[model samples]
Target: MTATVVVGAGISGLSAAHQLATETSDTIIVCDAAPRLGGKLHRLALDDPADLDQGPDLVDGRCGDPALPFTVDVGAESMLARRPEGLELITALGLDDHRVHPTTARAQAFLDGRITPLPPSNMGVPTDLEALGGFLSDAGLRRARAEVDHEAPALAGDVSIGSYVADRFGDEVTDRLLEPMLGGVYAGQSRRLSFEAVHPGLFAAARQGGSLLAAAQQVAAAAKRSNDQSVGSAPPVFAGLIGGVSGVITALEDDLRSRGVAIRSSTTVREIRREPGVDHGGRFTLVTGPVPAPELITADRVVLATPAAPTARLLRALAPEAATALAEIPYASMAVITFVLADAELSGSGLLVPPGELPTIKAFTYSSNKWDWIADRAAAGFGAGTAVVRASVGRFGEEQLLQVDDHELARRTLAEARAVPGWQSARPLRTRVQRWGGGLPQYLVGHRDRIQTIRSAVAAVGGIAVAGAYLDGVGLPSCIAAARRAVADL
Candidate 1:
């Protein structure tokens, strides 16, 4: 009997197994349905000429050595530095010195048919009305400013972020500001997302019956004060490993293997059932592998660290209530198109495209400009004129948009990307498109209540716990935190 069985080999599951390895001398085994261990944390290699699929000869030795491959993250590229879990994990895995932060490049937003600096805000909620002048119309700006005088009644229960923000600052603020900001994270419409779940700090303030603008200001001020009071220079908002964020997964995998933990990829946990009156070796039995001749593994404890759908399915028999709640959580699909260009010169870290403002493209990250390492590596690997750029496509409820073949999708993305100012002259050397179906979980209205119900149901089932991006947030730090909490609960 396995002492502990972790179903799912994503960052959350791996982190849980890591925690379990340190806490108990149990026979731990991690299983993932996907062929690869790192679920969304994938690192793509850009070395093979066949993978290029287009553009000039990258293998030519004129620019740099042809032997070395240029690597970049295709999934999650960076983790939040403000959250300690990601950084702490890095340090614990002896990867502290390899940590890197984004350069001091201001992000820009394409508004009103032109590019402009993104205004200061606390996650899309404009703390200062003056900053909205560049994007918001005169009347829209007045409406946002008028929020100070409006009587904000105490918020009762949960509501969509778009509904509440529009009620206070008008529809323009929701469309022009909040939509793109929230879209970048959840890839979901703000009108359908939960206010309490998305912005808890503002939600807590709103429950007290006060001006939202004032609440935003106070929150921003408190954040500034906290940063200012920190020991040395203020920490960056995000951090990535020097090689790639996927390094964390590789490191964790190695560490777990060294400790005698078993990781099984391409192995699906078809079902999990509670054993009756079995308390000696294990209490749960897991059915896995091919349906023709399934294998059973018994475990004393289990951690369900998969996405909403899979987790819900596995918990159907074990915890029906939790399964039902988990099924209610929806996910969004997206694609990231990475381009290596020759003689390209782009400014700023990236550009955000509000919904309806662009076709096929949601955002563009001038990765070579944002990360000095990418630039240095590009020059050393490809040539002095090479630049790396990533374009994000698709959003919540936009699955049909990504149905096209990779070549077609890349074509559409590249065409739209070139239309943006400063990117027109870019000559593509190579292009790769990575599609993530139902990658990000959406936090819809009443998400807080749903989470509570799921947690309550899971807690009642002895020796079982659930952890994933859907529980708290869709960030690396959040997943890590959830994993730790799940282990603690077990």
Candidate 2:
């Protein structure tokens, strides 16, 4: 029997292995550098309220009960339901009944020292300018209204999102509106991010040379029409499991184990080399483990489901051009601070903080208010007056802000949360801080072209393919889609 090796046991690699197992008879093996399996899809168990004083590290297993009532996702909380990959995988794992959607509560944005309702927008590009009265200043609103009059030729090539939006609307729109939305998703800077990679629909519309306001309105109308035409009342924009999004990883792991796939952790692939004139058993040899005594594994096929830097290192000798292109991709680091508060009620689902508006936190998610399951679990676990909230900090080029220890980080984030309009009286019961260093990949200008170059070079090398959040999109579904494509390519 032939064998295949998948490096990096994140969602992408695991998904690839599952596909290969289901379709072919190849002996599958997955290896990850970290001791844990799940990459960004991490669920942290909250200590029982009785053990609050013990500390964050003393989890439920050590304290009161192993089955903690409240467990929250520190990475991604939801997946885009519009994409079929995530939902299909969930269904395949027999988790359809466990699926849940966010409540009707809308999100808010903190601007000018006040929390205001977020206007109807296509990714922060306001579709309804009339709704932005209080959100924008008088002069800023006028400039935004004058977007139709600004005449310009069709877009020639890729450009930064901030530059394009500011040219059409104004600086305020980019700063107050666009920056916060993009930051929440990528922890990246708007001016440095690519327009083509971030907003492909808007980029295509801009290529025709017309009013962007009108283009945004048309796009929103198209989306509404598509939803109305669906078989039933339109599906929710996002979906999550009853317990946490990390439950998907758990279910996936169980399914993989049943298929007889080998899952190994704390085993890093140091390098990959292709042997010339070898065609019988396997051509690619994977060097893994420590430099002192590295272990070698042979495979007929290989899938690289890792971040840009490590992927570059592995492909340096085999595909230098691809490695060089992958190395150019940059990454951003951020931290998520989860707080369990007693005797407090938050109004909206969450509030986003534009850069410079707050000291550290860029956004806050009222988890108890957003998901019914979380509310029920929190009330049952702790008490009726308890609540759960998550505050996100750091951004691209803002590594210094996260250099402090966890205690200092949590203290700073909680202090800012109290200053928010409705959270002044929140008393912290338990707090957990999760830092993801070099977590998100930044799609700089001409990112599409760079991706093309990397893919072409890797294809030329043969017997190997790359998949990650950096390729197509940063969402869970996108990573899965990239993994499936890599499997198909092989």
Candidate 3:
């Protein structure tokens, strides 16, 4: 029987394969270059066995009790509790009861050498100038206030989020306020990321408005109203699994195996060969395996769930135009430094570092303080006074920072952590660095148009599907949604 081949073992790939397995009787084969699954979502074992996450991590935050067990979610730690897809999948995998939420969702920002509560914002763009003045300079505040009286510049097709916000609030606000939050999500330079692609709601509001600040307020209010009207009296903002986010992947793998899908780790696809006139009876041949011992597998349909770079490489010969567009999509590398500190007393989720404030690191999270499960684990095994803090370094266009040795990088991060409040007296018991090369995709200006073009090109080729963090969003929900959509298309 002709099989369906899925390239990459990331959530996107696994989700697509799972969907196919559920919907059809076709045999599904999943391949990945890495010896292990879960891609960037991996967990590092801690001295306290209870703290180990099974896979790699995505985003970050911090906070916890001193007497708690210190565990770290080295990859993505939480999902939007409101997004039903991730929860639905987790429940379907018999992990429904594992759902957990952060003890505290409040966060702060490190600005100009001081810690300040992040201003009320609509994805980094502040809605209230008075509240944000503590972080902004007099000039920055003036520029922000001026946005209300002034009309936003006419943006034609597509514009960078930074350019659009800067035109309204000047560079200082964009650099200090908007950049940190947006940078945290995309690891992209605001000047390059598309406004429409990154903040569609705000973009739509801006298009309808006389001023950006007013538009942002409207958007925030609408979101609040929508959230208030959501099914429950109150829905959680984010959710995590009891064991860890990696548990989700583990559960998924178990479920897929039970469904008769073949998951091959350490298998990389070198190229995809599209058969001519196969739109009627089309098939794809995948050249995979390492080096000289390459193996070929033919598939009735192919779903490329890998990141843009490798996907582009594989499709270079088969779908040149789509490959070109995929190749043009830029990526950013980042490193997460998880530090175990004894007798730590930090509170709140974490601190976001604005551009130029801390060139070496982007953000930091107090793990023990943020998640109760981590706190309980630490409390149970390690007794009290143990803390786990995670900090991330590197950004788009900042490859030099990521080139340093892990030891050196950890030293630099620890040194910087000392500067932040509550971390002054704490000493690290252990430190680990996880480097994610080409981890984040930048949604640059004209990104939507480029995606449409890519979609059209791929459709013309037929029997192929693409899904990943590069398309809809960089979060788990977005990847899962995109994966399901891709499978439906096939």
Candidate 4:
């Protein structure tokens, strides 16, 4: 007779619901504001030619550029082959072939800005030592290099990512490394992000290295080890489905439904009221939004896995203090414009701008060169023998860009990409713009503290739990982790 209700059909929600749904003795009901699941992780067709899976890049571009002529994955291009969860999910679904490797680069973060090259290790990180070497005078380079103390600093005490980076490297390095990395990954700002939260491994490595540089390198080396394992011989990179990440969602949803899970899409949850006086258990009073209003439905437990804003709103109705902290957690807006190209000449993975080059785009996946399938499908959707390329643009909070009409946005993104080193002479066949106004959650400095406070209040208030990219971390893997643990607690 015990039932659990999960709010939001996002990856986080879906992952948590999947566990609870299949668990013995507990029936589950999942609610989402949209008419479908997948949340921000979705893909669409390119002018009806083929579906374009979009979101942050997942699959690696190692197989070949997407513009070549073959199939490419849409979801994660190349997952950490080291991690079992993603692999397990793929295997259980009979998608073992979907799993591929990647081809990494020697000179990463190669941009036209004043960024110090991300130090060796993390994909998105640039280093002050490298930057100093790249831009400073001989004396400056020598001074900075000489300061390389083999001692690693303890990253235990709390600090903001920005403060930590600036203190360890320099303001310039932090701006380039901490800023763009966070922007590219979470659309967050280091100035407001918690050091421990943003770079847990970095902090942990520092604690272990006994010196900041050594710790940074240690973290980098561990990641490097993982990456090496992912691609034993081939170049280390990845790419995914030709249509889009939506393919993955489509497959998963179909599988879940076949298993008899009730998928009530567009069923907005207006509130999640916990039963009074229940410590570990409670009844959830669910109210679908104003439209398609369903009579109140009750449940023994509730799971919240939506974005911070909406989740915060609902939680506020039940717990005020928890709501405040959740509300305070900021989000970054974004937009994606996939451009179909006229030929394979302009095909290849795109470039990542340093913090200041354009301040808008963190980077673009050269879909053509990133995947063979995408590349081989040249111009199928466009003119015969043509090509397809996607231009993803905008920083998280560029309000003006956020408000841009699709046409203008498309034009701007194409123009921006063309301005890159080699694309100066190319022309775009067509453009498709997808807007995500409040999509990315910014993990500002002290975010961990804020989340801690929110969780404490939720526990004190009644039977409730918070789960999503915001609570634990962003990205597909992280979302899955957060959801599984929350629902298991039910």
**lDDT of each residue in 104-206, candidate 2, tens digit only:** 9889998878889998889988898888798889999999999999996788899999888899989989998999999999999999999999988888877
Worst 10 residues of 3 by lDDT: 52-61
- Candidate 1 per-residue lDDT, tens place, 199-229, comes to 9988887777778888888888877778768
Query: All candidates' TM-scores?
Result: 0.96, 0.96, 0.93, 0.83
Candidate 4 at residue 139, lDDT?
54
From the highest TM-score down, the ranking of the candidates is 1, 2, 3, 4
The lDDT per prediction is 0.87, 0.87, 0.81, 0.61
Per-residue accuracy of model 3 over 1-490 as CA lDDT, tens digit each:
7689999889899989888988899989999989989987888755532222222221122333444434456878788777778988888888878788888557888888888899888888888889867788887788778887775565566788898788888888889888888888888899899999999888877775478888888988887778888864666788888767878888889999999999999887888886666654488888887668878898999889999989888878767898999999999999898876765668788888987777588888878778877766765545577677789888899988888776677777877778877878775655678898999999999899888877777777778889999998888988999899889777
